[model samples]
Structure formats: structure tokens, C-alpha cells
Target chain A: MDHFILMDAGLGNFVVFVVGPIFVGFVIGALYLIIKSIVVIRRELKNEKASDNENNEQIK
Target chain B: MEILIYLIEGCIGAGMLFIAVKFTILIESPIIISGGVTENKKYIASINSITNVIFNVVLVFISFYKWPVSSILWYIIAEFLLIPFSEILAYRAISKASVKQIIKITYCANLLSFVAGSLFVFILIALLGLF
Candidate 1:
């Protein structure tokens, strides 16, 4: 029983050490990209609206 | 010794962040910007974001492949704090913020994240030793 417990602990640690960082990194990277996309879309919308307003003023 | 270790880790964290930011600015941002003015902004943004996410994931995997201490919780905390930096950079890129302003903001964010992340890592490593 003691040997089994030790083996399990070692395996768990190995998995965490090998896999955890990659998983975390991937999550952070995806998040950054998604946020960047939102910013770009919002800015584009603002610019479009500004252009539209300028066009209306010219017509008037 | 602890302080020295912390200081070195902090600098490493900061350098890593700066490099990531620079990579995003120079490579990923350009691809997103290549969409012409007449293109649907929403569509472009969606595609760009998806593509960039994929790119970043690959980069991250490579970065952490052989790195020490794969503590997910600590990494998550550090990254969550760093998320705002990327968001701010993205906003600035889209708004065409002055280059100097962008650089300043990036530097400040990098510094902040480095300190926070380094401290977190230090505590985490110590805690791991206890376990």
C-alpha cells in the first residue's frame, strides 16, 4: 500500500509538471488574441461611424 | 539568496512578456491589419483573433515544453494579470495610438506583471517544496 501511494504521487507530479505549463500558456495566449480582436472590431466600428457623420454633414 | 532569486525571475518574466508583446505587434497584428478598409470589420476581427489565438497557443506550448515547475495555478494567476496588458496593446494598435505611447504602456505593463508574476512564482515554488 505504501509503495502504491508513492507511485501514484510520483505519477501525479510528473503529469502536472509536464502538462500544466503548456495548458496554462495556451489559455493565456488564446485570451490575449480574443481580447485583441474585440478591440480591433470596436475601433473599426467607431471609425465607420465617424466617417458616416462626416458624410452627413457634407450633404447638409 | 531568496531576494536574488526573485530579482532574476522577475527580470526573466519581464523579458518574456516584452518579447511576446513585440512578437504580437510585429507579426500577428500585421496579419489582422492587412484586411482592406472595405472589408467587414467584424469578420476581419473574428478571423484575425482566431488565427492569432492559434499562433499564440503554439508559441506558448513551445515556450513551456521544457520549462521547470509546471504549476498551473501560479501560471494562471500570473497570466490573468498579464491579460490586461495584451488587451491594452490591442486597443492601442487598433486606435493607432502613438508609437511612443504604445511603447510606454507596454513597458509599464511588463514591469507590473513581472513583479507580480515573480512574487507569485517564488511563493509557489516554496509551497511546492513543502508538499
Candidate 2:
């Protein structure tokens, strides 16, 4: 029983040490791209609206 | 020693935050400037290019920070996974497809990114048993 517990603990430690960072990096990098894209899209929308308004004013 | 580690981590955290913000600005600026003139596809492509460059820089920074053959290898692999994951999430959230879609996809994307970033640090600590 004691040996089994020790083996489990060691495995857990390895996962934490080796796999955790890679997972965290993957998630964070995903989030960064998502946020950056959103910002760009919003800016684009605002520009589109502004241009539409300018075009309307010219017509009037 | 703890203080030293924290300080170094803090600096790295700050640097990462700054780079993220810089990329956001770079992606946004062009759309704002050429709003009406440029097609949506073109604008998005430009933003994608800028984001890619920023991502590359970030990967390079992470590599240097972890320098010393043994430790750095895992970190670089982690970075590789991160770059694409973030990009796909952001792109999906941004490109709302139809013109009439009323949902604030951009805002959603940003919020998701912020949460993910914070959670990532915690996950890293847990994984590395650094804390």
C-alpha cells in the first residue's frame, strides 16, 4: 500500500512539473489571440460606421 | 531567494502583459485608420499578421528567459502550444461572419483572454510547484 501511494505521488509530481506549464501556456496563448482579435474587430466596426456617416453627410 | 524569484517572475509577468497590450494596439490601429476604405477581410488579415509577429516575439522572449539547455526545452514547447490556441480563440470571437450579428464578440474575446491569462499563471505555479 505504501509503495503504491509513493508511486502515485511521484507520478503526480511529474505531471505537475512537466505537463502543467505546457497546458498553462497553451491556454494563455489562446486567450491572448482571442482578445487581440476582438480589439481589432471593434476598431474596424467603428471605422466602418464613421465612414458610413461621412458618406451620408456628403450625399446630404 | 524567494524575493528574488518573485521579483523576476513579476518582471516577466509585467513584460508579458505589456506585449499583449502592444499587440492589441497594433491590431486595432490599422482598422481605425482605414476603416471605411479597406475591406473587412483585408483589415482582419493585417491584424492577423501583426498578432503573429507579436506572438513570435513572445515565444523568443520566453525561450531566452528559460535559457540553459535542460529547462528551456519544455518551456519552448509550451509556448508553441500557446500561440496557436490563443489565435484560434481570438479569431473565432472576432469574425462574427454575418454583418447583422448583434453579439459583442470582441468584448467576449477580450474577457476570455484576460481570464485565461490569469488562470495560466496559477496553472504554471501548480504544475511547477514553484509556489
Candidate 3:
């Protein structure tokens, strides 16, 4: 059998390949989520400020 | 020696979980706040974010325990399942669902994924102990 398959056959190789990548992917995915959220939050805050300014101008 | 490995594993596991939860919250926050959804939906999203953080912490704890290869396979499976599951839950919660429905679905999905991930880690450790 190939090395990868052999590794899969045993638990140790499985941990290094399968578990390791999954954890790494999870971390990356999480980081992506955080960055995306921050951008969205900033946009929303800007919109809120603009709307507030519009209302004030209308009153004046 | 094992202790050192366990410690390192614990740190990495916890760090990953923290990052994941933080990212999820950041991704969903704007959607919940600006979607003009009901207050209930907003509240549910907030609760889901908090729960996700807590769940990741628990996963970190489990990962720290150390496990054999057979069990590690299960952990890998659990981790894979959580990725899409969490995304769907967040999407649904922040979207058009009624507050009640959002709460039920988010909670169920998050809890299920968390438990599965934790169990997989736990089982890996247990199986390793057998050898």
C-alpha cells in the first residue's frame, strides 16, 4: 500500500493527516468569519451615521 | 514528555476554537443588526454567538486530553461536520426566520455539532488509552 493509505490504516498517521488538517481548516475558517464580521460592522455603523445626518439636515 | 505534548495540544486547540467563535460572531453580527429583523431574532443570534464560544472552549478541553489514531479519525469527522453546520445555522438565524424558529434551529444545530466534536475527541483519547 502507499504511504498515505498505510498511514490511514494506522491511527497515528490518521491523526497527523486527517485531524491536523481539519483543525487547521477550522482555524482558517474562523479567522475568515471574524474579518468578514468586522467589515460588515463598520459598514453598518457608517450607514447609521449617514442616516442620522440626513435626518438632522431635514430638521434644520 | 506526554505532559508537554498535552499542554501544547491544549493551547493549540483552545486557540483554534477561540478564533473560530470570534470569526463566526463577526460574520453574523452585521446581518443580525442591520437585517431589520425582529428584536427576538437579534437576541437569538447573540445567544448563539455566546454559545458557540463556550462550545469551542469545551472542544479545546477535549482536544487537550490526547487520543489514539482511531479516535482521532472520529475527531476529524466531527470537525468537518461543524464547518458547514455552523454556517447554515448562522445564515438561518440572521436571515428571514421567525424569532422562535431561529432560536430553535440555531440552538439545535450548534449544540449538536459541539457535542459531536467533543465526543469524537473524547473517544479518541479513550481508544488511545486502550493500547
* TM-score leader: 3
Q: Write the per-residue lDDT of candidate 2 for residues B6-108, one digit (tens) a residue.
A: 4555455445545555554454445433432223664554455445445544555556564656335643443345433454454444443432221233333
Interface RMSD of 3: 8.6
The sequence of per-residue lDDT tens digits that candidate 2 reaches over residues A21-59 is 544454455456656666776787677778778989999
Go through the candidates in order and give the clash count of each.
Answer: 0, 4, 4
TM-scores, one per candidate: 0.36, 0.35, 0.37
lDDT of 3 by residue, A1-60 (tens): 598777767888668755665565555545544555555545644655687689899999
Worst 10 residues of 1 chain B by lDDT: B30-39
Docking class of 1: incorrect
lDDT of 1 by residue, A1-60 (tens): 999999999999766654444455446546765677667677776876788789899999
Native contacts kept, each candidate: 0.18, 0.03, 0.04
Q: In candidate 3, which residue pairs get closer than 3 Å at backbone N, Cα or C atoms, i.e. clash?
A: A11-B69, A34-B23, A37-B26, B71-B124
Model 3 chain A — which ten-residue stretch has the worst lDDT?
A: A25-34
Residue-level lDDT of model 3, residues B46-120, one tens digit each, is 444444643454454465666445446544554445543554554553355565554554445444545655676
lDDT at position B82, candidate 3: 54
Better by TM-score, candidate 3 or 2: 3
